[model samples]
Target: MTAERIPFNSYLALPEGKEFSVKFKERFPFSVNAFGLNIQHNFSDKYYMAPDKAGVEILVLGHIYDPFSGRSGEDAVLEIVEMYSESKERFYDILAKCSGRFVVFVGGKKMLEILPDACASLPVNYFSPAVVNDSNEFAVSSHAYFIREAFSLPLCSNVRSLSSTRFYHLGIRHCPADMTEVEGVKVLTPNLSLTYRAGELRAQRIFPRSNRLERDVNEVINEVSRVLLSSVDCLAWFRKPIFCALSGGVDSRMTLAATVGQRDNFQFFTFAGEGNARRDLLCTKKLSQLLSLRFEEIQLSNVHPSEEFSVLYHGLQGETRAPNVKDTFARQQYFGVNDNFEVRSSISEVSRSFVRRKFHTAEMALTADAMVPIYKRVPFSRKWHELIRQEFATWMERSSFRDVEKYGYDWLDFYYWEIRVGTWQALVLQDADYYTNPTVLFNNRKLIELMLSAPEKYRKDDTLQVMIMSTLDGDVLKTPIVKNFGKKAWFREILESSYLKAYQALIAR
Candidate 1:
């Protein structure tokens, strides 16, 4: 595909007095400039605007699902507008019940509010210094590259040297949750709402409401299964073709199980590559054959990245460089199958204590020092270490980390949800907008809270996933999951079991 054929679903927003350049205007024709805000998007349906009873204009970009009313797309947007019009104080509460990848812009008479989804999956990067400057010329975008270009911002010095070598060793590919590669620009963290008033912009936490009650583990599991299934059903309600990603992992398996009744409306696909990906291709083929489901395998080896592909990939992905850019391009080409919704299971990790170390206890204090090692496995230079440390500290300060106990949350789990997935996985999905319209069935805020409320033992194991699959389709769990590749898997399983036994014995003491 040529660069011109690449879709630009992202948007850009600027203050009232400022205007997008002629070049940008030509790219993004759908726009609304009113009530102290100027916003533009490439797709008209993805951008919706309506006035509330009070005449305050509410603009929404991207899709949303309201499980309560079984509403999605434009209907969901209207519901949000009505809810905000009714009670601004309960706006966050209303948002907590909905799920999607979206960024909302509410331009009131005196203030403008920008609300990202619970995971900030759509990503909002803005020029921080401009937000409070005397000229009030703030700029925000779904793509960080746009923000950098519009403001002539310098790239963060540390990010310029980032390469796939560092990522392979350290698992550090993206900036922290509260930062971007552009100097003086920051990303809006998950569960936080941003508002501009009196020439000042402020972001505040909105979810994990204080003084919440925990439920029984079984109850939480059952409710989570219901929400997961309902979310998938809601997606099918759109009458659009749905493509569910199938892998040999518990998360993707559960995502497939949730589509039990909607099998006729969905197709399964997997990426064929080395290691775990090859296993994924094998397992998905078997499962799909057994269930008589439509399936396709896209070979990652077929990708040959060109210079033009690199420029387009970097433009959409910004500073987050994936080693699989060629494969991503291949997937984008495969999306020619149809204009469909891609179901991903990436968000399911939030409930599985994903960031918790083997020996770390729930009571252990979460600090920048602790997080740095988790992200960067190999030792690095002092400058890089300090950069990673400072970035974690800033993210911790901006998030609700200090109040985790008050909200009945584990600090490590909170870190995984707010920082790890919120930053890294969210950016991955944003970059994938060029490839496919992706949605996570497990991204509902209430559903995630339900997963977190379960006992850690259940979450750490595959119990939660198994239980949900059992409820949806018992056949899904019949195929063995491919955890590793080849004879190495046998020895790795033994080592993992021995390590778990040792840890359990220590805990018993």
Candidate 2:
């Protein structure tokens, strides 16, 4: 291997004759660094970055574990290294098999590649034609180390022709505009791979489909449960206490119950808002107490209407044209930020600017070695919202989701680039210290299958079904707080009110 570019708190080495280079955003924010044959793992308690011999890199940002056995047994970095070495040639195959919230970039001896998890947990982007290299240059992964130094421009639409990919308009945190030229930019799609080799670029799918050998509902449900259980169990790689976000909803209720029986070293966290049901919290508290496990309740105050624009702009990161006043306020309250008048004005202006400046095309926002900062802020205006809605609708129409299953894929589709990738991308890039929702790493598909597979008796009686699903029989639902509000009428009212408020706010904004 050549020593042309020294590793900066990193273990990046190029093969003989060929050289490698890197630029850090801030001196590699990690604790310990370990290296294996052609691979370097930068470990931090919160997250980790690993790069292998093939120049493929993976950045894990959230709680990832196997859902089945509920064990943190697998070594993700090592697995990635092994996978890349064995299947380096099959780009999409490598990406589809990896687990966790991450951005995977595979750069072979001559090709630059990018892929997101099948669930779109992390973000990745690309730009071509070396504004710095002049030779074919493309970047992948989450850092700007390669773009900031490699190119001399702020991360925004430097060129206009290439800004049509789906990643940028969706408010993805990893898609920056200052790194590469717009005419040469592309955001790699989730469950897909972009390969740039020998002056040619191609995109391909990697995830495989189920055999479609029809089976009974019971059988399907069992398999679903098994998959989810394994997925969660595998990801719980924590020596310290682990926390889960508990909601009074079906998805969360079952997850909490399963976790209780699966892992002993676990705690649950719930968020409480004014006028919201206490059932989930009550259940979480009771379960924790009963299990002799630790639990915490994170309470959020109500946010006012006046501060809606600011919160929405920031949370959505200049994308999302719809302005749901109550939703915005709710998010602000949940995030525990003061939404004053000045904050509103600043955010509104930024939102408006984003609407105005966003060229109706795809482009590279940054170079491979660019720094991740609050570059182009989103603007808030009715015109911006209208444009965004229309554009988003069109993008959805063009989306290619046939490759993935439609069970939990609804969330993946309706959310695709917007909520799933958008929300976390912004969080990871903005607040380095913040943690991600644990439920994300679990096997949600299995949960959905379980719900859909229930007998007609339980499935037909939605009320009874929800109650049963709220918490493990006595652990969560037995609490006084949960008992008081778990009534069918109250549950129905909560759903209706929340949905009504969301709809009204969306239209009003």
Candidate 3:
């Protein structure tokens, strides 16, 4: 667990007979020192002992698979420490061979530190009362939210929120500290370190993805897939009981299929909406059954608009405004809602926002509802939704995506930054960071390249036709449970005949 390292003296201070607790889910290599604690989760595995080792008392909540253990948790941590610096290399080398999420704590010289993985797919949180003290550090399942709930602080707001508004139009409260849900609090960033000592605090970034795209597409995709699959396998490492979030989408289905028959240690859970309202849930169920895996479907119907709004509120926090959701009246008006009434309900105030932006209402009126009728007649609405979703996947994308040719940076970079990082940041905040691969958006590059090089073959199926044709194998296609049950033909017909045809016709015209 040494690929990433954090000093244990960051977030701990001791009170007499101080009994502290650390709790982590799906993270590993839990460690504790007199001054602080170090926990390794999915991403990295090593914990740094206090450089200034004093009587550091540490407590940690770790996983059962932790490589080291003893009669007491503190002793277990000591057992895992590499006493010799030279041997440390080999020690971590072995640790890297291990995977999963864990939490560790170390405290000494009046400091406490906790480490979560760079890609924290697991569940972990920290909460401390608003008052800062020597023994005030706490860890929970949802750090910012649990902390805010524990301390009664309003959510933080920062540039991330604004970025979401301008592009994706969603408010998010759960971005890392680099982003503010409120004024002062921040979530720790991936591959980041936080040191709290002497009533003074410091934070620094330790890991960053390389900016260069020197590697070939095959290399990039292979490496990315390895890292991602390792993450998935680690989360599914638990033996006693395991569960996965099944979204009934391509992403989640791929994840489920990869694990099917691979182990008996896994279970799948999905949320089904009432009737047709929860098409995703139904689809997920259908897919799970086909896999013959243990499954649980949690049906949710009549969810208050507030619940979705709450997720948007705390999820994106300030990142989204009323103007972001197309379903919302304000957002519709902002987008010339009247023109797309059939696509969505119309708003009477479209002219006001359009006028303020110096847009001619009459011009927009011509195309406002243009998508609705066009969408209805299109044979590829389903495929179009996916393509558009990819385009608008990240909050900052919309800014540079339009007329991408005029933009300086590679359109690939724009797509990469938005989908891989920005979108995940928003999803992580919502604790809904499921199986969406940020890197997959880059697939468009491959598709485009292939199309340019060999347009005739690529154009034969088009995008929708290609995806549908590939679904011939029920076992291989990874469709969700409901869709697999009977909706396969239904979905195919709808996507191909109605949406796909309309979509292709629009493009041809």
Using TM-score as the measure, the top candidate is 1
Residue by residue across 1-509, what tens digits does model 2's lDDT show?
12122111122211232223342323334422212112232223233345555565443433343343343423544454466667654323333334444444444446555555444433444444445456554444333223333343343442221234332343333333212232233444444556667755566644333322333545544554455445545545454345555555444554554454555655556666553444666566666677665566876555554443444233322222223335544544454332110000001011011211222212222211111112222223344334444433433333343433433222222232333334334333223121222224331322333343344344322332344334333464444334324566556445544533443345323
Which model scores highest in lDDT? Answer: 1
Q: How do all the candidates rank in terms of TM-score, highest first? A: 1, 2, 3
lDDT of 1 by residue, 390-467 (tens): 877877776656777677777777777777677788777765676667778877777787777787788876777788
| Local accuracy of candidate 3 as per-residue lDDT tens digits, 1-23 | 11221111112223324333332
Best-to-worst lDDT order? 1, 2, 3
| lDDT of candidates 1 onward, in order | 0.71, 0.38, 0.34
Clashes within 3 Å, all models in order: 0, 63, 80
**Reference-based lDDT, residue 128, model 3:** 42
What residue runs in model 1 are displaced by over 4 Å at the alpha carbon? 1-8, 107-109, 131-133, 161-169, 276-278, 357-363, 378-382, 484-509
TM-score quality measure for candidate 2: 0.53
Whose TM-score is higher: candidate 1's or candidate 3's? 1
Better of 1 and 2 by lDDT: 1
Please tell me which model should have the higher TM-score, number 1 or number 2: 1
State the weakest 10-residue window (summed lDDT) of model 3.
Answer: 339-348
